[model samples]
Target chain A: METPCLVMDADLMEANLHTLQAAVNRAGKALRPHAKSHRCSRIAHRQVQVGAVGICVAKLREAEVLALSGITDILLTGPVADSTRLQRVPALLERAPHLMLVLDSHETARILHQSLAAHNRSLDILIDLDVGLHRTGIPPCDAVSFARALAAFPTLRLRGIQAYAGQVQHIRAFEERRTASLTCMKEAGQTFESLRRQYPACTIFTGGGTGTFDIDIEIPALTDLQAGSYALMDADYRTVQSRGCLTPTHTFTPPLRLLTTVIGTHHPSHVTVDAGLKTMYRDGASPVPAEPEWSHLSYEWFGDEYGRLLTPPGTRRPRCGDRISLYVSHCDPTVNLFDAFNMIRAGSPAETWPIDLRGCSQ
Target chain B: METPCLVMDADLMEANLHTLQAAVNRAGKALRPHAKSHRCSRIAHRQVQVGAVGICVAKLREAEVLALSGITDILLTGPVADSTRLQRVPALLERAPHLMLVLDSHETARILHQSLAAHNRSLDILIDLDVGLHRTGIPPCDAVSFARALAAFPTLRLRGIQAYAGQVQHIRAFEERRTASLTCMKEAGQTFESLRRQYPACTIFTGGGTGTFDIDIEIPALTDLQAGSYALMDADYRTVQSRGCLTPTHTFTPPLRLLTTVIGTHHPSHVTVDAGLKTMYRDGASPVPAEPEWSHLSYEWFGDEYGRLLTPPGTRRPRCGDRISLYVSHCDPTVNLFDAFNMIRAGSPAETWPIDLRGCSQ
Candidate 1:
C-alpha cells in the first residue's frame, strides 16, 4: 500500500460490528450507526446487513449519498433550516422513502413544511431535544410546546425525538459516563413521554453514542441508538472503559489505522511521518502509533503534511522510508480527509471502500 | 448565500495580492505564492499573473491539479519519499517542465532518481533544509553533504534550496518574529553559500512565509518567498503585527469568511451557528464572527455541524435563519473542507472558484 493510506482491519471491524449490534440488541434498542464516522456506503450496507435499523447522518449531503446507494431507511441527525438545503429534501425522500429529518426550531419546521408543501410531499421528522449539548436542538423544557406547535406543519410528521449528548460521549470513567448520560437521557425520556401522550404514533426516540451505548439503553424511551465510532474506534474512545464489563477493558478495537511513511529523518531525536494535522484529525486527543513498540514515543504535529515521532533515549528511531501505522485522534474528520479506506482482512489487503460521503458536510 | 458557505472578497483578495507582490518586488526577491493555502488554480493563476514567478504546493496531488489546470512552473514544498508517489514525477514533469521537488534525504533522492531514470526524465530538485521547524528537511549542517550525495543520481538536477520556517510564521511581535526568522534564514543562507561552490546553478534560495516576508528579504541569499496565507488571511495571522511600519497594523485584510446561518436559538444565552469544527479549522486559533458589530460574542464548538455564540448579559442573540459570517482560524485546512469559494465582488455575487486541490493532501 502507498504511504498515507487509511487502512481498516476487516476482521476486527466485523467483530466490532457484531459486538455493538449484539449489545444494542440485548438492550432491546435499534442500532442506527452514524455514517459520519466512516462515510463509506459499504460499511453502511454491512451495518444494515448485520441488523441496523438505519443509518444516521449529520448532513443532508451524507443522507443523499447513502440514500442513492440504496439505503431505504435514513435519518439526518442535524437540523436543516436553510431553504436551499430544505429544497434538496424531496429529491432525497424520493430515493429513500423512509427518510427522516431532525427539527429543533419552529421557524425551521415552518420553512421545511412550506418547502415540502410546494411538492405536496409530507416528511417524517424527529424533534431534536437539547439534553445537555447546546450545539443544536430544542431544550427538553420546550419539547412539549415545540411538538404541539408542529401541528401547524401538517406536511411534516412528528416521528420522535433526537437528544444526543455528544459532550457526554467521552467521559473516561464508566460510572461518570453512565451518570452523565442518564441525567441527559432521563430528561429526553420525560420529554418523549410527554410527546407520546399527545402523539401516540411517535415511537422512534433515538440518540446515543459509543460511549453511552449501554447507559442510554437504560432509558425506557430511547428506542434506537445512534452509536457511531464503535465500528472504527479512535484514540479518543479507547480511554473510555467498557460499559457493562467487570473490568476496565475496551469493547471495540481500533480498526482504522493511517499508514504514513517516514518522509524526513533529519531531526536527531525524532522521525517525521507523512501524516500530520491534515492527515489525522486532531480535534480531540492526539493520535498515537498503532504499534505497541512505539508506545513510548510521542507524536507531535510538524506541519500540515508532516508529523514527528519523538525518539527518547532507548527508543528505536524510525528511519526514512519506514511506514508507521497511526491511531487517529478523531475518526470522522480524519476519514473525511481520505478518498478511500484500504480494507485489510487478516492483516492482508482485501478491498477498497470509497468514502463516498466524505466532504458531505453541507 | 447558503449557510456554511465559504466566501472570498474579490476586492480585498486583489488588494492582498498586489500588496504582497509589490512587497516582494521591492525586496528584490521572487514571490512564489504557496498554493497549499488556497488550492484553487484560478487563484494560483491570478498570483502568477500578479508577478509570482510560479506557485508552491505542499503535495504532489496539488501539483498534479495545478499542472492539469495549465500551471507551468510549480514547486512542491514537502518531501516525497514513497516509491509509489515518486513514480508519479515523470508524468507531472510532462505537464510542467519546470516542476521542482524538495528532497531532504539521500534515500529519497536515490528512490526518486531511480523512478525518474526508468522513464528517462530528469527533474529539478531543491535540498530541503530544516532551519527550525522539525518537519520535513535536512539540517543545515548536513545540507552540503546531502547535496553532494545527490551527484550519484544523474536523472535529478539540483536546482536550489528550500528552507521553510513554519514555526516562526505566527510570532505576534514583529521584532521577535524578525529575529527568529533571521536566525533561521541566515543559517539557510550559509548552507546555500556552501552548496553554490559545487553547484553554480543553485540560485533559488526560496523560503519565507506571510509572517516573515519583510524580514526574510533582509537576507541577501534568500531568492524567493513561499508565503501562502497572505492571500487569504486568517484569525491567527491577523494577530501578527505588520513588518516594516511605525504603526502596528495588519498589512493584509482577511478576504476569506465562512458564511453560516443561525441554525438553532433554543439555548437561552446562546445561538447555534451552522459552522463548527468540520466547517472551520480550529488548529491554531478560534474563529471569530466576521461582522465587527457582533465582535463581543464568543464562538464555541458545538459539534461537527454547529457552533455556539455565547450571548452574555445585554448582548443580543441572533435569531434562527440569520446569517453569521465567521473569520476562519486557519485558511489552509479550512479551505480543504470546502468545495468552492463563493466569490463576492463589491458586495455582489461574482463567480465561484472550485477548490480543485482541496483534498490533495496525499
Candidate 2:
C-alpha cells in the first residue's frame, strides 16, 4: 500500500474507449487516436480493436514501442529529424509496415526522400497543414503543390493531411468550442479538397485530437481522427468547452487519479502531501480535491517533494495517515511521473498496472 | 537505444560528492545532502561514504528506499503521515535503527506517538520551522513550543529543530545569498538558542541545503546541512539569483544530458527535434543546445514530441538524424521521468543504472 500511487479505473477506461469509438461512428468518420496521451501499447491495441483505423504516436520511439506490440498502422503526428530516428524508422516500418509519419514541409519531404533513397526504402508520408494552430505544419494554401511534390517523391507517398487544433481542445464554451473546432477543420478541409483535386484521387486525410475529434468526424475529406487523452481526462480538460458536450453517456471517463496521503500538518489549516511537482504535473495547475467541501482547499507547490494545502478555516480535516485523491491538472504528464497505475475496484485488492509508458520519455 | 535517456556521469557524480564534502570540511558544517535530487539509494550511499553525516529524504517513501539500502542515519525532512507510511515507519526503523522523521504540528506528533506506541516503538523527530519558505514548517515563534511539547510523547523524541531557507537557494547575489543564508541560519539559530537554554541537554540541531552548504558549514548550533541537487546541477540551479558572492563554481558538471536526434527538417532556418516536452524538463526553460553557437538554434515547444527550432537565416541547419545533446531544466523531476540512467564512461558501452528510487515516489 504505497502512498502517492497512480490509481486507474479499468471500468472507466473501457467506457472512455467505447465513448470515443461511438463518437467516430456517430460522425461517420475514421478514427486514429493519438498514442502520446497514454503511450500504452495495451491501450493502443484496445483503440485498434475498437475500430480506430490507426494510432498517432508523438515520437518514433513511441511508434517503435507500439509497433513492437503489434500495432500495425501508426501516424507519426510529430516531426522527426534526427539521424538516429531516421535509421530506426525503417526498422519500425519493417515491423509495423502500415506506418505513416507526418511532415509539414517540402524540406521534410526532401529529407525523407533523400534519406529513404539512401536506405532503398520508401515511406507513407502525410503533409501536415497549419489549419489554425501555428505550432507546426505548412500553410494550408500551400498544401496542394507540396502534397503533389511529396506524392511525386519515389521514396515517399503523399498520404493526406494532418492538422491538430490544440487551441480548440481547451475551449470551454460549447458553441464557441464547436465553432472553433469547425473553423479549424474547415481550414484543413479546404486543403484536403484542393489536394484531392490536384491528385485527382483521395488520399488518407487524417488529423484532429480529442478536442476536435468530433469536429473532424464529419469533415468532407477527413479520413480519420487522432484523439488522445480522452481515456484519462484531466482537471483542465474537464473545464474545457467540450466538457459539457461530453455527457455521461458520451463522456470519455477519467481513469487516472493520484492517490496521495496526508504527509504532515504544517498549519492547522494546511497539510503537506507527498505528491508535489515530482509526483504531479504542476504545469497546468494544482489538482482539485475529490471531496465536495474540500473545494476551499488548494495546492501550493513550494518544492518537488511537498504539496501545500490551504484548507478553509475550521474545515473538518483528515487526521494524519488519511488518504486523499487528486484529480490531476493534466493527465498526460502527471501519469508520466508514475511507474505504475494501481488498478483498484470498489472494495477489491488493488492490482498494479505498470505504466509501461511512464518513463518512455524517448 | 532510446532517443532521450537520463544519462548520469558517475565520474561527475563522484566529483560532485567530493565538492560538497570538501565544502563541508572547509566550513565545518555537518553534511546531510538531500536525496530528492538523484533519488537513488546508490547515490545517497556514495554521499554517506564521502563523509556525509546522513542523508535528507524529502518524503516517507524516499526514506524507505534509502533505509532499505542500509542507510542508518536518515532524516525525513518534510512530513510523514498516512497509515501506510506510519505502519512502515517501525519496519523501516527496525532495519535502519536510526531514522528521524519531521513533524510540524502536535496533531501529527500525536498521530506518530500513538502509532509508534501501538507498535512499542519510538522514532526520532525534528521540529520543522518555516524559516522563510512559508510553504511548510511551523513559524519560528511557534517552533519552540511545538518542539518542547513533543518531548512528552513516549514514542516520539523531539531530537532537534529543522529550518531551511528555500529562497536563499535561488539568491544569485553571492554576498546577498550568503547574507540571506546567514540570516536564515541566525533565525533558526535563535530558535535553537531558546531550546538550548530551556533544554540544557538538547542534543540535536539540524539545518542547511545545497544552496547553503557552505553557509552552514560552521554554524555553531546547526548539526546538519541537507543540500541535494549539487550532484546534478540543472539549468535552473545554474541561475539561482546569480549570487555574486559564492564565486559560482563551475562545480555542477553537466553530466546528465538527454541525447536526442534531429528528426525532421520541417522548417528552413531550423529543424524540429524529435525530443520535446516529453523528453526533457522545460520548467526553467527548454533545454539549450550544448553547443548553442554551433547550432545557433533557438527552441520553442511545438507539440509533445516536437521542439521547434529557429536557426539563424544563414546558419547551416541540422539535417535529419543529427544527434543533439540537451540538459534538463530541472534535474529531479526529469530524473523521476526516466526508469534508468544510461551510465556512459569514456571507454565502455553505456551501462544501465536502475533508477532504483523511481517507483519509490510513493
Best DockQ goes to which candidate?
1
Per-residue lDDT over A240-345 for candidate 1, one digit per residue giving the tens place of the 0 to 100 score: 7785664534789899999988877766788888887777878777888899877887888877777889999777888777888988988888888878999998
lDDT of 2: 0.73
lDDT of 1 by residue, B267-335 (tens): 678888878777787777788888988898888887777888888988877877788888898898889
Model 2 docking category: medium
Model 1 misplaced stretches (Cα beyond 4 Å)? A244-249, B244-249
How far does residue A1 in candidate 2 sit from its true spot (Å)? 4.8
lDDT of each candidate versus the true structure: 0.87, 0.73
Residues B1-362, candidate 2: write the lDDT tens digits. Answer: 56766667778777888987887777766788888888787788888899988888877777877888899999887766554456678788887788988877777677778778888998877778888776667887887777668778978876778888887776666677788888877878888888878776566677776666666766777876788878887766666543343454475676777777665564566666666666665677566666665457776665555575677887778766676667778888877777777876772446786677775666
For model 1 chain B, give the 10-residue run with minimal summed lDDT: B241-250
Q: Model 1 clash tally? A: 0
